[model samples]
Target: MIEATNTDLNSPKTESQSGLASLDPRSKILLACGFILTLSLLPPGEFLIYGLLLIVLYISASLSDCSPVYLVRRSVIALPFAFAAVTLLFTIPGESLLTLPILGIDISVEGAIRFASIVTRSWISVQAAILLIILTKVADLMWGLQGLHTPAILVSVAGFTYRYLDVLRSEASRLRTARQARSATLSAGRGGGTLLWRARVTGWMVGSLMIRSMERSERIYNAMLARGYTGEVKTLTRFELRSRDYWSMLVAALTAVIIILVAHFL
Candidate 1:
């Protein structure tokens, strides 16, 4: 139900390309999928692979004109969950590397290593996904997902959500601005009742936004019906897989095999 803000949806679209524009959309999608799958399936206990993937992602982001600091900052929001999972590794019985008598806890070196590895791998994987979103438009990505066998219903929902998110976000922002202006005028000298008033205003704003969104949805459906839209959503085709896509797929397969083999024997 949450919609994307206009700035959130449009800022990435205006990003300066770093030569990736030459590659067809299919090739880019293949490369992105290949990298994500290969890295994710690799053993998370190994720091070397995770580190390598992080470096690869950083380089990729840099080449695509994505700010490394911004990507890392945004990616860290999910780090807490990763860290919580990592904490469990220390609790499970394993070879103890150190015992902290004051804390009454035994730390396993293997557990600590695995924890770091998983966090790093997760961060890198998220960065890859964020980069893909930044580089490709939502419509193009949805089409690519459809070609890759994502269910039609889910794809339709994703397309609709993307299209309406900006509209909803704009409405929310405008309401927020109006509330701030009213507060400034009504509470210029008073401070005690500001918080309560703001909370009430926010609740009302949310309710109004929902009602407006529902009305807009009805209008959109009616417009579609007037245009003779059937159950299917028609979209312009813009992608074709080239030799590069095959090459990327082969590299991904090889990487997966190699990682599995390494995890098994080494």
Candidate 2:
């Protein structure tokens, strides 16, 4: 079995020194879930509420020693996925905003508002999750999940997935190195292969990687079984909630409640 590296098991110096990062992972997890849930509950077109929540997110980012620009850049990853909500631009019933020139579809004002809300909600939620990931090490995260009564099997799977992503990445790197060593370049310094040939080679590389990964995984599993890994992730550090943890949770819960209440009442 592969040994966990410090990079995998240990929190970074920045996280260790940050105030918010010092909180128990359980508290962070709960706060993120509550924030996302609150965002989901807000009615469509609650742009003011969304903007306020974004301010809260940025404040948390600053508390954790993360850059607001970096957080925003990472959060933009959700936008492409948010495009799935585009159909809502025509599906929701309301006054027509404009007719599409090509599709001849009339975009409803309500649908546009709903789509914007969905995109904003998704972007904010992803940033919240990214903050959690940035602050906690994988081992600590897994331990926190276990402590929070997350199912053993799911926690185990998550732990393995996080650990082996680096393994898979290393294997891919090796494959790329080997490919480059073998690949020829043309006089113009471009790759020698035609488009189709390059595609075929890429497919072959993928297949080879999959086969090798499967074989290695089988050996790793057998070795793990010999070492008594029974689908339970164990950590040396025990997670106990402190006063700060409770206080943080309380503040987050109250903030979420207030946001929800304001969204509804105001």
Candidate 3:
């Protein structure tokens, strides 16, 4: 079952107080985009600039009532993507830092620097996104995208995907519960199943889920049509930027420009 979003964009949630959560979603979106863009422009080996960026992020997080430890913990999602850059250690030509013990291959200094930079950038970017989500509700984020002149179709898709995530999760949970109920226990109190048998059952569950989801989608679509559904998502919540919103966005833009310039020139 899909849950409807009734939260207002202008109203702050109970947990989030009147700081970053009170700011206009449009300004927050623009600030996050500018910050990520500035981060991407920095060249490798700029550890000082990266440190400065982290400081800026920390300050922003504090203003938003977001814990630094929580931010760091959530940012670990970037580590797997960072590992994708591991090939750069052998691909780039530079002075050797050290030779691998098993392969006897040398790791280049330039490659190491680049890898570190990539990891740092990815970590910072993910935190920025997390901060945005923490500050704004999913409905408000979608509304902000519409305010920013983003494509309506894209916005609708993102909004629907987020809205139905709980539905899919509930369906999956029911399937898991049913499986557990039907499964037999072995002598050791573990579920009785060979590896291949478990895999086959998993495959069947996935296929069954796919078919059920399709049928549910059709029913939901018919219900929507009956209720006068439209192609574009319309919301009652509106955003009006105040003086503080303007000032905050201006300050963030200037700060991003200064940081990018400092990285490039000095």
Which predicted model would earn the best TM-score? 3
lDDT of all the models against the reference? Answer: 0.73, 0.82, 0.81
Candidate scoring better on lDDT of 2 and 3: 2
RMSD of each: 4.6, 5.1, 5.1
Tens digit of per-residue lDDT, candidate 2, span 161-244: 887877786787677777778998787867768989988987998999999989988998999999998866567877789999
* TM-score of each prediction: 0.76, 0.80, 0.83
Tell me the lDDT of candidate 1. 0.73
lDDT of 1 by residue, 1-266 (tens): 12324235544443554644444666667777777777777775777767766776777677777776777766765666885775755676789988877987888877777777667766787877777777877787888888878899999988899888778787888887776566554445543357888678769999999999999999999999999979798888677876755665677678768876786578
- For model 3, give the RMSD to the true fold: 5.1
- Model 3 C-alpha lDDT per residue in residues 137-219, reported as the tens digit of each score: 77888889988999888999898887776787679778877887899878786667898898899899999999998998899
Model 2 lDDT on a 0 to 1 scale = 0.82
lDDT score for residue 265 of model 3:
90
Candidate with top lDDT is 2
